[model samples]
Target: MLFTPTVIKNLLKKPATRLYPFTVREPFPNYRGELYIDIDACIFCGTCARKCPSQCIEVDKEQGLWSCDPHACVYCGICRDTCPTKCLHMKDVHRKPMTERIMMVEKGEPPKPKKKAAEAAPKAEAEPKADDADKGESKKADAKKK
Candidate 1:
């Protein structure tokens, strides 16, 4: 063990590896790093969650929550690529080491439901048309055509 080349190299030469915690390394260009979502820009679509191969993303449109499990994410960048609103982005930096898994959740306003035809019809019938002159002209034209 004393004669080992590794021991001799360690003693003679500088360390090949840097102290990671002390020396931070910058990520390369086009690197598919951790996921980052712009919650304000997001439209609460489940497209990102559906596109993720790891299935780490969870989108709830009704409650308006977009969550991602960092522990389970493989950093594949599929979610970012497939986001319709272009809110999801792949950042160069990654999340720091954590003891426990944490799901990142962003809450937003829920989407408004569309008005049904039955409900809309009553509202239209209740309001009186203001342009009586235009209506009379249309009726006169219809009578002439008949």
Candidate 2:
């Protein structure tokens, strides 16, 4: 009991606790961090859903959608790799807040029609010259002679 008390007193030289949030640590290069979904690029492929070990990614084709519950994700990065369109990317970002809504594709919304490309301003049409017309006629006469 006497030795334990003496050892404890000496061990408390300085507090080793680090102030988190303020003192951020860099994650490893291979560290699978937060997942970001690019909804527009996603092709409704079920590969992400099938590859997810935790079954966190949900891909409903009939409804044209994919959604993942970050709470259930294990950060394996499988969902990011298996996506064919390269829509899913793993980013080293801050954790999602509880107030953030989960991603889900909306049903019954008609797909927006593709916008017609802007028409390039019409180029000024060249006026046909009398000399050019005469040259064309002579060329045609020469070809007929052959």
Candidate 3:
């Protein structure tokens, strides 16, 4: 008799869970869901690759390529946090289900090589002023006399 009443009460109560696929819940604010990169801003410094615990990120500075294996990624946001250029970002929504494996690759312009000190030194030496030249000659003449 007691069990009958309990069962009746439970049966009359609404379900505890929602229809998940039909009614998706909104993601929480600042949720790290999906990883993405702004290729233009990336410096290919390999900081992200080095910091990734899963080792899913790959960077080629010479080729200016940044690639990530989403299947191997843990979505922990470590790569995003370590990026020097602030190019890495995470969206609020998670990545969609995929039927096949795919690589996330981004190509950008490589950083230009820095000028060598040896190349710069000659430029400075070639630009002597007339007054400076006269001073140098006078100094040499005085040294010869001494």
Candidate 4:
């Protein structure tokens, strides 16, 4: 048969199917797989948590805490879409399987920028105080000329 070469080539090639744990197929560009939060950009506004249909997200603005349940999330991406700061991300990578039911929580504040000592020193003591002396000398010189 003329199909003999095609059959031989297909047989020699690797199988299309792969073991899941060993190899993961790349997710499509639009796949909504998991949630990621950029804590610094987040204003502790509670908007995303309020918009979640499943109520998986919990925010305590007073305590500066954010918590989410991965098991409870449906990956519908409503929270990501509603974020005012666009701090939430619906990534294409799936959440890893977990044996325990644990709340994913992040707390506290974003790190503050450090003030430079060199900049502070220049601000405090850089004035020359020579203008007043220059003005007095100029007045004496003018009186002498008169």
**Lowest summed lDDT window (length 10), candidate 3:** 124-133
Among the numbered candidates, top TM-score falls to: 3
Worst 10 residues of 1 by lDDT: 125-134
**Can you tell me which runs of candidate 2 are displaced by over 4 Å?**
1-17, 94-146
Prediction-by-prediction clash tally: 0, 0, 0, 0
Better of 3 and 4 by lDDT: 3
lDDT of 1 by residue, 23-83 (tens): 9778887887777888888887678766777767777665779999888899988888788
Cα deviation in Å at residue 143, candidate 1? 72
TM-scores, all candidates, are: 0.64, 0.52, 0.70, 0.62
CA RMSD per model (angstroms): 18.7, 22.6, 19.2, 22.7
lDDT of 1 at 15: 75
Q: Candidate 4's residue-wise lDDT over 46-121, tens digit each?
A: 7877688876787765466888989989999998988988989988888888898888898857333246665664
In terms of lDDT, the best-performing candidate is 3
Q: Give stretches of model 4 more than 4 Å off.
A: 1-14, 110-146
8-105: candidate 3 lDDT, tens digit per residue:
98899997688999988889979998899999999877788767877688777668899999998999998888787789999999999999999999
| Order of models, best TM-score first | 3, 1, 4, 2
Instruction: Show the lowest summed lDDT stretch of 10 residues, model 2.
Output: 117-126
- Quantify how close model 1 is to the true structure by its C-alpha RMSD in Å: 18.7
Tens digits of per-residue lDDT, candidate 2, 1-146, equal: 76998689769766466588687677667667788777777666468876788766766544556677787888888888778989888777646577865654433322332355223211111132334446557966997999
Global lDDT scores for all candidate models: 0.76, 0.65, 0.82, 0.76
Clashes of 2: 0
Please give the lDDT score for candidate 3.
0.82
Q: Positional deviation of 54 in candidate 3, in angstroms?
A: 1.1
